[model samples]
Target chain A: MKLRTAFFLNTNKMKFITLIVIITFNTILHSQSQTGLVQYGHKQSMGMGAPIGIDYNANLIFDNENSLYTFAKDSLEGGHIRESVYIEKDKDNFFVNSKITNKLGFQYYVDKENKKLLSRDIGFNYVKEEIPTINWEISDEKKDIGSFECLKASTEFRGRTYTAWFTTSIPLPYGPWKLQGLPGLILEAYDTNKEIYFYFKSIKYPMDSKIKIQKPNSESENKEWITFSEYKKTLINKHKKAIENGRMLIEGFDSADTAEDKYTMGNSYIEIFDNE
Target chain B: MKKILFILLCSFVSFGFTNERIEPISENESAEITLPVKVETYNFPYENGTITLTIFDNGICEQGTVTGTLSTHCDDDGIADYVWSGTICREHIDALIMQFNASC
Candidate 1:
């Protein structure tokens, strides 16, 4: 009878152990199911890192000696802006290609390969230009960005402020736009609104083929290198006549048959294109 | 044998109670969650229409259908008045607060 009692107690202990093991396993499974699964390359491939719906408002104030001044507010409604970014990396150098679209259906492709930057205006035809090189000062601030550690950096080029955040965690110095020169990958960068904003969307590590840095096309060869300020001046001069024609068309001058009819048009055009 | 059976029954009861009586963790105990969302009210000019949006927290957003006269505003007139209805998730209250602060 004592032996039988001993056997029964041992069986009970075994059953208790089995139940505890099962409970622990169930709890672990439940916790694992609740955890989020992260996709590493999804944002990179879709180019979704660009901040959507960024509203830009600029107030232009003109002051005269007579204290007569006028202020005009220009606001840009937010929309989905698409940018195409391409990156390739080798042992010593990196290549980056970025394309930004404008309202006039023109696309600007800024290519940086082998520490050289080329800016190309891509329309129905390509107008490529070489940009003057500017030196960058690497910063030391560490930023945690979506499972990557990025370092903050800055550069000043021709009255524009260029801030860059790069991550050495990815081992590729390539980033969006012409921003580069880090140990890892660039996450977010901008030139203070006057230029451009290149936000880190994703990083791709290709499995095959070495990255080859391609030279700019022959048409872009031997072009005069200009500062960003000079480029802006040239762009304004090129689009000045077109902007005037657009203003006239928007004013309904083409539809008016008489001068008085045109004169009766309200000052809405003044609010629209007062930048000129 | 009777003692063994009684012990097994007691263990089963204890297990059942532990499973059924487990309490959920309160929101205060959890980490802070911030979601980015936007809501806008628009009144169409010339036409009598209104657009109202309520974005949810889980990113499963819903847009209230637009209704009213289809007129495009050429002048700087006030938007038309229309009614829109939609339910937003409870967790999106923080997102609404952030958006309000940004706009203000």
Candidate 2:
């Protein structure tokens, strides 16, 4: 009876120690933050005659398995109006809204452990997508961007084929926007059509700052997330309703003209959709 | 009379469409603080041709102008290392302009 009681006590103590060990390991793995900055030059357009070239700075922050990528301009510029238009009474004025490079204000969070991505859309709604696997075929070709020697890699993502140059010197396995899955940090990437380009200007490692990446609640009573395909369908339906209700009408133009103008002069998503 | 009106209308349209660059100038203004924040005006020849009244922290611009014309159309597309905006509150910009004008 004494031996049995001692054995039982030892079993209970072992279970308690196991639980504590698991909890401590989880805390250590999840509580650390690594933040870095990347400067990028972009050339994008509304599928018009020529694309507009622009520049941007982005912040890449990550923990052990999750990473948050956001535009540094939107995070720092605070509240600044982009553009506004005032109509003249009975005057035929042609005005185009400023072409936005990253209109979605997308905060892309990658969960490597789950093989998924959480993106904050334009309407402040979140969308979770399976990370697109762009079976990258790396080539032995190499070049130097700034001080780091970079290797060339190519992959087809969504509807566009992209060529990317990454450096193993950083070994961050991250890049601006949605381009990732490389073994190293991507310094430059451009699609075949050159409609979009991301050239690296500078990089900061082990940044002297702490960035908190808070994931939006998806299970709350009011918060929700929709799949990318479902969101596209909803967007099309919303546009159809807006057209039917004449809410998207120009003062002296028909719905067809407005739609054409929207497609021609207005901006499009970086990932071109077949629905368009 | 119709010809005159047409020419006048043409001139008015030209004035409305032409790009204009306006810069505010000041010389005698001085502040007592170690670092002074003053208002400076700049007009850029970029996409939208924006005119901005900037609140410049002189502490950062000891080497003359840091980003005068660069931050015209928002800081994201500019050449400046820092991001700033020309869309600051008009009242706040006006107050800075007034203070700079009055300081000595």
Query: Quick one: best lDDT, which candidate?
Result: 2
Q: Over the stretch A200-223, how does candidate 2's per-residue lDDT look in tens digits?
A: 777765566655666545564276
Candidate 2: regions farther than 4 A off: A1-35, A41-43, A48-55, A84-95, A99-104, A208-210, A217-222, A237-267, B1-104
Off by over 4 Å in 1: A1-115, A122-131, A170-173, A182-184, A193-195, A209-234, A253-276, B1-104
Instruction: List fnat, each candidate.
Output: 0.00, 0.00
Chain A TM-scores, candidates in order: 0.41, 0.67
Question: What's the DockQ for every one of the candidates?
Answer: 0.01, 0.02
> For every candidate structure, what is the RMSD over all alpha carbons to the true structure, in angstroms?
31.5, 16.2
A1-276: candidate 1 lDDT, tens digit per residue: 999999999999999999999999997665433311111111111111232212222111111100000011111213323322223222321112222223322122334332334443321223444533546677777887777787888887544467777766555444443444456556676655422444533333331222233333424434454554454454444334323322322222111111121110011110111122
Residue B35 Cα positional deviation in candidate 1, in Å, after optimal superposition: 49
